[model samples]
Every structure is written in structure tokens, then in C-alpha cells.
Target: MDMNASPVPKAVVVGAGPVGCLSAIALANLGWHVTVYERRSDLRAGTHHLLAPNTENNPRQRSINLTLSARGIAAVQAIDSALVERLLHNAVPLRGRMVHHLEGNTTRQQYDRGGHCLYSIERGLLNLILLKAAAVVKNIDIQFRHKVQSVDFNKNTLHLCNLVSGQELDDHFDLCIGADGSHSVIRHHLMLATQMEYSQHYLSHEYVEIRLPQGVDSSGHEAYLLDPDHLHVWPRGSFTVVAMPNKNKTFTSALFAPKSLFDTLQYPDTLIPFFKTHFPDLLSLLGEKRLVLELQSNPRSQLITTKANPYHKGAVIIIGDAAHSMVPFYGQGLNCALEDVRILSILLRKEKDGHDPSVILRVLNHYSETRHEDLVAICDLAMDSHLKMRHSVATWSYMIRAFIDNILYAISESPSLVDLSETIFGPQVPSWSWLPLYSMVSFRPDISYSAAKKKAERQERLIDSLGVAVGTLGLGYIIYSFINLNRLF
Candidate 1:
């Protein structure tokens, strides 16, 4: 059978966020008829709820701005390099983290020795850009305000409602891709069809969105209240405040704390005093009036970590948060989700030589089996990073180790030296250089999450051995000096 003469496969993508939009784009580019169904109003139309000021009564509308790294850009680049260029033009580059101390001090921790950095972009803005790109594609149809009520994986059918017109309809597809996020309706339906091991854990902590407006600098020109090149962080032990810059000179900040602490700060009297004590510098940046207004108005959202095994069943598959949702501490949730699109695209393209329906199923099954290990590694990594962001980043011991490791990395980068991977593992491991865990995850798209985790563990063991060797040498020198002093006496 001629591949070109075969009927084009049709795919139904659930959810219209960055991941969903990217999925639609990739599938369409792969010669599939793609339709994207989004439950919310089109943010591109300016009617989306996120455009309005977030209030206490509003649904979860606040945007947790994304930190775009190598993995995410790789996905977009696969579809269109121009789209990557457009998105980065609108984003502010985050060189590293700006750690604000309690004692009125700040420190910068660069992400990598090689100068790669993440880009900070608004969530709604990113979605709009993707939607615009998808709109231009001839093979894609985007349906906004369409809610998925139920799904039958075996039948490959979906029951959907038009949220705007109150019309309900049933749609069928050759393939179904679920990107509807952590609380996905498609995921719920998938569970009914198969015994998918699933689990969700809600952290005791919650978060509220806050805005830091531009302020006049010493020269009287309006400027960013915080450094635009860094992701500003106020790590206060069990709680933390993070701020990411926007192109408009303002910043979107979030306060993450225990729900018990949130309960105590129900009003200005409590909230103001709490900020004054723990985050005095940020209090001044936000100002007393605006601080109280935003704190009281913004909804407090719970943080959740979701995991599911075998992300596919029959012809249906789940990607992004629908399969594995992690906390934002590591800032890889969006990056990882976008990477799913990239990985899936590679697998699906392999079967393009022949339009065999069975080949598609085999590819999906292979994806589910192979992709889970990397996703699980990242989900666990994200959970562990919460402690690092809130506590370890501020500790003196952590700083010292990071400094020493960075120095070692710099030395290893010399042209005269052998590849770090070969030096550590063996000559057969190829020439990948050593990097810090943050660098490996964020800067190296070629490294899988599982490989990065395993490599980081190996790096830690090597460092421990070096520490012991250095300590032993110092002890031997001290003993010799003591014996020589005793002989002189």
C-alpha cells in the first residue's frame, strides 16, 4: 500500500495549554488531522478569565509563569524554529537565582558554568503564542470552551460540551492524546478502562499570587523593582517567596507557605506583620497598600504531585500533567511536559513510512514503557527540590560545596583535559561533560531525566571520596608537625 495514498490519521487532543497546543502542532506536522479541545475560553481572544485582575472569588486563574529551558525550546523548535524565536523575544532571560537573605543581603547563584539560562514567560502569553502558531496550520482545528465530559478508550469516542453555546456532541478519533493537566477528566476515564496505578499527594503548603510593580530608580526613571536577569527568591525556612520578571518591567511573585500559616494571616493586621518579620525587603518592594490588596484578593492554591503508570491504553495516550504532574519547585513541570511532545513526535514519526494502524499502537505502547522511568525520575526530583529551594540554597555548607564543584567543573572544561564522562565512567561512555544537577536537568536536553539522576548520584559519590582524601591528607600533615615539635622539645 502506498503511504501517501493511505488515509490521514485523525487525533483528538484534550486540553489547550502549552503542552496540548504543542502536541497538536507536532501531530499535525506529522500528517495527522489534529483537533485541540480546550475547556476554558480562548486566552488569545482577550475574553479569558486570566486577563482580568485575580480576585479571591475567582477560580484558579492566576498564572504561574513558566521557566522555559532547553527541553521546552527543543520541542518548539521541532515544530517551527521561528516560533521558538518569537517566544524568546517576549520572554525575560533568567540567568540564575537571586537569593534574598533575611539580614538584608542577596547572593547570585548562576545555573551553569557554560552560561546557559532559563527564560521566564507568562503562562497565558505562551499559550496564546502557541495557539496563534497552531491557527496557521492547515491540518489543525482548535475548539475553545469545549469541555470533555467523558471518554470511552475502547470505543475511541468522546462526549464533549460546547461551553459557550451549550451544545453537546460526540466525537471519534483514531488516536486520543490527553494533556488536560493534573485533574484530567480523560485520566479519570482512562482509569475506568485499565488498571492504571495512580497516586496523588497534596503538600501541606499552599501558594498565593502577588504582583510587584515597577518603581522609580535613584535616577527617577521607572525600572524593575528586582533584578530582571534573575529569578528572585526569598527562602524563609519552611516558607518562601519567588518573583519572576515580565517584559513590562513588573514582576509576578508568589508566596508559598504552610496552610496553617496562611490561616493565621487572614487580614492585613496579620499578613503585614508576617511579611515585615520574615520578608522585610519584599514588603517594601510591594508597598504596604498593594501588598494587602493582592494578598487578600489572590486565591491560595494547593500544590499537588500526581503520578500514573502506563500512560497509554489501546490507541489513547496521556501526556504532560495527565501522566505525571510534579510540584513547581524545580521549575521543570512545563519543560518536562513540552519534552513529552518532543519525545512522542520522534516515536510517531518512525511509523510514517507506512500508515499501519497497528504500528501506531505499537509505538504508543513502546512510549509508555520507555517514558515512565524518566518521568518518575523527574517527579521525584521535583519533590526533592522543594527542600533545596527553601532551605539548602540558604545553607553555608551547600554554598561551599556548590562553589567547589563549580570550580572543578571550570577546571575540567580546559581544552587539554579528557571528557568528564569518559574520565568518570570509562572511554566507552562518550564525551559528555560533567555538570551540576541543575545544569544537567535544565541546560542539557540530550540527557534523559533518569540518566541525569543516576549520573548526579555518581557525581555525589565521587565528591564524597574527594572530601575524605583531602581530610586524610590534612590529618597526616598535622600528625607529622606534632611529632617534629615533640622532637625539638
Candidate 2:
């Protein structure tokens, strides 16, 4: 399989999540006969998965609301510009981070000098669009309720068991993609096949979904408890709560807490008192009775962060959550997975021996090596932000430094900071060598995402010091001139 020269082959993608659906979309566009196997039923069935409150108070309601920042939008735009625009309709553009203090005083920090908004959207809606797009492609077929049980990478074949009927079958493909997520069967098979170093850590934090109702405001468009145009974050330090609005006048809220805190929550009786005390006025719209019931009934989702040394074998490759799973605090989980679809398509089209499974493995290894640093950085940031969200604003020292940092972002995001903002928002610049942070985060044309991040950080330090030096020099010159005038007089 010389990757430098062949046509598209039969590709198998496991998982029907956003990442998996996007992979199927990309592969089909690249002219491959792509098949996607998912364990869940089709999302387009429109069966309301959300049991929380809605405008109609209809118990059957739903939303997978997520903060879709520039990086995510860029990735989506790269794949299909129209889909990006279509998704924007359901999204509320957030101009900046709206920090909600316990006292009710708020601060708005813009992300871009031009006031660029990070779109917030429903996750399930995005998945449906991707799935529908894949359905339209003649090269793809999506099989729901088909669970992949195992893979024999050596033989270029996969073993799958039907999730519904308990029927087992074996199939072969030129390339197999494990976009199945953290507990990917493909990733598991790859680990057993070769010498792969894998590490997984379950963080101390936990997340449980909460609800906020939608009501008509004084003006009459749908009204929400929190501002709809912004991403609402209640940073409390040890724990935090955030909300993203949906089309239904209601807002989907999540509570992130330490295991200890969640474990202590048992009955509805204690739940309301605690929420009202901790979150204060937030419970006004969300009623104490409902909050307590949700805390007791809703499951607390665990956070699992992981990394795999190499992502490929003779016929298999793992992408999305399978390759690197991080916490959802950053809201990049689904978007990052979609980005993988784009990257994979680029690689498949470029590889000369496109049909050869062996070549695919080599490419997969290169992809893993290149992506490692960025994945690690995001995972760590997600973990650290828990502290930032819950407590940093409360500390004067931390708040001051953060304010300065925000100012820097405002400058960097400026068009005057053209090269700077582009780098800050993502990794796509070609010429301007950015500091590691800039490079990894935004300017990534030349270097790998990891190396770029390193450069962006180093650049930030020098840039900050340069400002200080110029200010000091100006002050010194003014003082010297005044002394000379005084002496002359």
C-alpha cells in the first residue's frame, strides 16, 4: 500500500456521534465507500431526549447545547461552509465571556476586537445535520444499532455485533476509523495488536445536567433566566455552573462539582436549599423542587481524560474521543472530533497508495505524533479552568492578572493584531511566526499544533516585557528632561 498513489477505498467508521458522522461525510466526499456503525438510534427521529422544561412545558423536550467558539466554527466551515451558516441560525453569538458574580455584578470581555461571537448551539441538532448530509452522499451508508465488538487489524477485518438483534457478523475494509469515542473498540484492538503506550486518568470532577425555564420577557421574544446572547458562567472556584440557551425559550444548564459534593446530594429536600444558597438568585426560575429532583434523578457524568501513543495499525486508525478524550469544560469535545474528520480526509487524499491498508497505518502514526501536544494542552486547560471558573475572580491578585491577560487578548484579537488574532483564534497562519500559545492556538500553517503552542507562550512573555520596557524608557526620558530644565533655571 504505497499511500502516495491510489484511489479511495472502502472505509469503515465506528460510532455515530458528531465525529463519526463527520468522518463519514468527509470520506464520502473524498470518493470512498464509507460505512458508519453506531449503537444508538438515529437522532433525526426527533424524539425529544431532553426531559427538562421547555416553552410548552411539554415533558418530551431536548438539547445538547454547547459553546461553539471560533476554532470549532473554523473547523466546521472548512468542511462545508453552508452547514456552518445553517448551524448559525440555532446559535446565539457570544461576543465575550460574561462572568456572573455571586453578587450579581457582571463583566463582559470581548473575544475579538471586532466583537466576534463564539456561537452557542444544540449538539444534537449539529449531529442531525451531519447525519443528514452523510445520508445524501451516494458513497455512504449509516447503520444504527450496530455495535463493533472487536477488530482483527492483522487481517484487515472487523467483528461486529448487532446491538438490537444480537446477530454477529464480520466485514473487511481497506481502512477502519475508530471515531467511536473514549472506550473505542477499535482503539482497544489497536492496543492489543502493537506496542502502544496508553494512559487514562479520571479527574476528581463530575458534571450533572440542570434546567432553566423559558418565559416571555418584557419585549416578547423568548426570555431566559440568563442573557441569551452570551455564554452564562457562574464561576464559584471549587465548583461552577454554566448555561447555554436553546431555541425553546429555555436554557440547558450544567453543574460541575467535585465527587464529594455530588455524593453528598441525596434528597430533593436538601438539594433546593443547597442550590439556592450556592447559586443564589439562579434558582428563581429553576424552582427549588425541580432542582432537587434533577440532582437526585439525573446521573452525574464522569470525566475521563486519556491519550494514545500511536493511532494506527495495518488497517485501523482511531480519531476523535478514541484518540484523545478531554473534559467538556472547554466545549471542544465534539468540535475537536469534527476537526479530526477534516484532517483525515486531507491525509487520505494526499497519500499516494490510498487503497493500501499499510500506508494508512503509517499516516495514522504521523497524525498521532503531530496531534499529541495540542491534545494534551487542551485536556490540561479543561482541568485547570474548573479552578478559574469557580474561584479566580474572587481573588484580587488572580483577577488583576486575568484582567491584564484579557486586555492582551483584546489587543491580539484586533485586526491591527491581524496576525495575532488569527493565531489566537486558531492555528492557520502561514508566515508570522507566533509564540507557542499563538502558534498552537491559531497560527499553525508551518509548525505542528504542539510546537506552535510553545512558540505562542514564549512570544507572549517577550511581548509583555517589550511593552514594559518601552513604558519605562519613556518615563526615564521625561524625568531626565525635567532635571536638565531645572538645573538650567
TM-score leader: 1
| Cα lDDT of model 1 by residue, 1-489, tens digit | 787776787899998878888899888888889999988777676647363221323554586688999767876776677889999999999999999999999999988778889999988788788888888899999898798988877678889999889999998888899998888888888898889999999999999999889878899998998889999989999999999999989999899999999999888899999999999999988888999888888888879999998888888899998999899999999999988887788777766552365887898888889888999999999999999888889889889989977886776542222222112111222334556778768876767788879878888888899999999999999999999999999
Each candidate's number of clashing pairs is 0, 32
Q: What is the lDDT of residue 243 in candidate 1?
A: 94
Global CA lDDT computed for model 1: 0.84
Each candidate: what lDDT? Answer: 0.84, 0.69
> Model 2: how far is 263 from its true place, Å?
2.1
Residue 395, candidate 1: Cα error in Å is 1.8
| Deviating ranges (above 4 Å) for candidate 2 | 1-8, 46-64, 219-221, 393-399, 406-452, 459-489
Candidate 2 lDDT, tens digit per residue, 6-72?
5657888987777787778777766789889877666577553233211123433333476665556
For every candidate structure, what is the RMSD over all alpha carbons to the true structure, in angstroms? Answer: 4.2, 6.2
Off by over 4 Å in 1: 1-4, 47-60, 218-220, 353-355, 413-432, 483-488
**Residue 386 miss distance in model 2 (angstroms):** 2.6
